[model samples]
Target: MAKSEVIDVRVSRRVLWVGAEAYPLHNIARATTIRIEPDRMAAVGRFLKSLLILAILTVAAVAVIGRVDWPSGSGQDALRGVVVFAVVMVAVFAAQLLKVLMTRTYYALVIETSGTPRAVLVSTDAREVGGLVLGIMDAISNPHAEFRTQIINYNSTHIGDKINQIGGIGNVGKRVGS
Candidate 1:
């Protein structure tokens, strides 16, 4: 297994360094932490919905086959095809469930600058990120405050698009009767 990169973070009165990316303290509008949790229930709900649709389709197919009188061989072949399709669908759902179940919770150091808000550092360790946030806050308040820390296993939470998509669903951002 590859060892995680020991990221360098430095906070002074002027600049904040996360890895090699530096943000001047004056340009940093806000600095905070966000928890990224996988929506496991949503994943399970989707799986159940898919399963219901498959069941409904299977029932409809069986009902149609029963009502329509065809050659004996043709009816059997159609039933076999339905079974194969159902099996494939089940396999796909199982894989999706496994991925959801295996996902872990992550903490992110979100910094909002003049450009766009970005997650400068992400890790599974919450305390480390929290400490970093405190350090940044201290630096902003006290000019002489400074600190350095190392972070290993920098995992990404893929939250860049998610933050921008908030309140974008339904009629939140749309004008009615436009």
Candidate 2:
């Protein structure tokens, strides 16, 4: 890790018996989870849409110009082109649908293709996660930034109380996202 590289390390609260996995904050390259597939899909869709529109416009212009012999089987060629284009559009739609169905949202310590730990935690509240990650990373890298005593809760009641402390009382009894 470069000294100038900013990395945030978040601890994930896993299952009860498994314990929290945030500290010994080494090899933590990021605090936030990365999402890539949706953007990729959008880009591909944009490209295909533009290509489709261009093809249609080109065909329309050719028909209007009528420079080619219209009576000598060019109409059959145009029909063939239209049929092929429609099939391609349907194929693209089916491929996109299959990709959507196959893709699953994962929350894990992913290794980038370049072989690096991508993040320290997943599905974190960005507001709290960043500060905590920075704090811990700083403490580890610079001894003077050591963390002071802080409450660590192990039960639902204590966790709820802490959440209430942060003015999340309304979310106390509900499951996440409820």
Candidate 3:
């Protein structure tokens, strides 16, 4: 992802300005922070399935080779080929598992307007997003309140909407087993 621009945020005279998008404070019914941890179970499951298939194929190949008669020197050559293929498959599986393990967690400042809730700012840094949430809450009640902060718009979904969309956390897509 590209670097995020330093967004301008100000809440004054009942208006909340996030970058160039201005929202009236009254329109914002609620504001809160959510910690979004990447769901990796699906990726892990795929890796496991691939490994299982590879294991079965390797066993089948060995069994067939042992039972079959080949040209004087060809049997050993075929076994070597199987060994090389298995090694490459294992390496690919390991790389996939590593990628899933390295996925980052995200923190977001979500604001619920009269319509659906939206993620206005997202960061990998929890403190930055948490502080922004508090500032927004303060601005909601205090018209004179103002806040300024920089946020990195990391790749993130609207967590509030996701909770509702997936029928709340731990129920479905976010976890391994419903």
Candidate 4:
């Protein structure tokens, strides 16, 4: 299957924004927005660390209790068990702790149509997320327009008749005629 057919966009040193060949850029019917969320696997390392710690603690407890040899004085004692368990746990903890560090964020590019968002492009690089979102918006707004600046126009004035309303529907014409 074609890469562009399945994925809405691709990124590297630069982002390659593409849509379905049938609809292309002009088929982008409505506005879109970008939302940043923690990746689903962002806490996977945390889960692994929790499991590792739990295992180590359980094993240490077992070793502490199991070291007491009833008859044989030559058996490994509790002191050795405690020391060995501590060293192993500490070493594993540091290694697993690096994996648990939260460093990835998910950027979701929501493509809307007739007010409902249908397509979403997710990315790990949050730095380019905003730019990609703007690029998509700019593409939708003016397909031929170049991505000149990151200056987003937040103030899109959409006025409605409700602005002049005094209270409710009862005061709609009352405020105007008076």
lDDT of 1 by residue, 78-146 (tens): 888988999999999989988987887888899988888888878888998898888887788778888
lDDT of 4 by residue, 27-46 (tens): 45653445544543545666
CA lDDT of every candidate: 0.82, 0.46, 0.80, 0.50
Q: For model 2, name the residue pairs that clash.
A: none
In model 4, where is the ten-residue run with the lowest total lDDT? 148-157
- In candidate 3, which residue pairs get closer than 3 Å at backbone N, Cα or C atoms, i.e. clash? none
Residue 28 CA displacement from its true place in model 4, Å: 3.0
lDDT-sorted candidate list, best first: 1, 3, 4, 2
Which sections of candidate 4 miss by over 4 Å? 1-16, 19-23, 29-69, 72-78, 112-127, 146-178
RMSD of each candidate relative to the true structure: 5.7, 15.8, 7.1, 15.0
lDDT of 1: 0.82
True lDDT of residue 139, candidate 4:
60
Q: For residues 66-163, could you state the per-residue lDDT of candidate 3 as single tens digits? A: 88999998999999999999999999998988887797877877889999888787778898878877888888878788877666676433335343
Model with the higher lDDT, candidate 1 or 3: 1
- Which of 3 and 4 is ahead in TM-score? 3
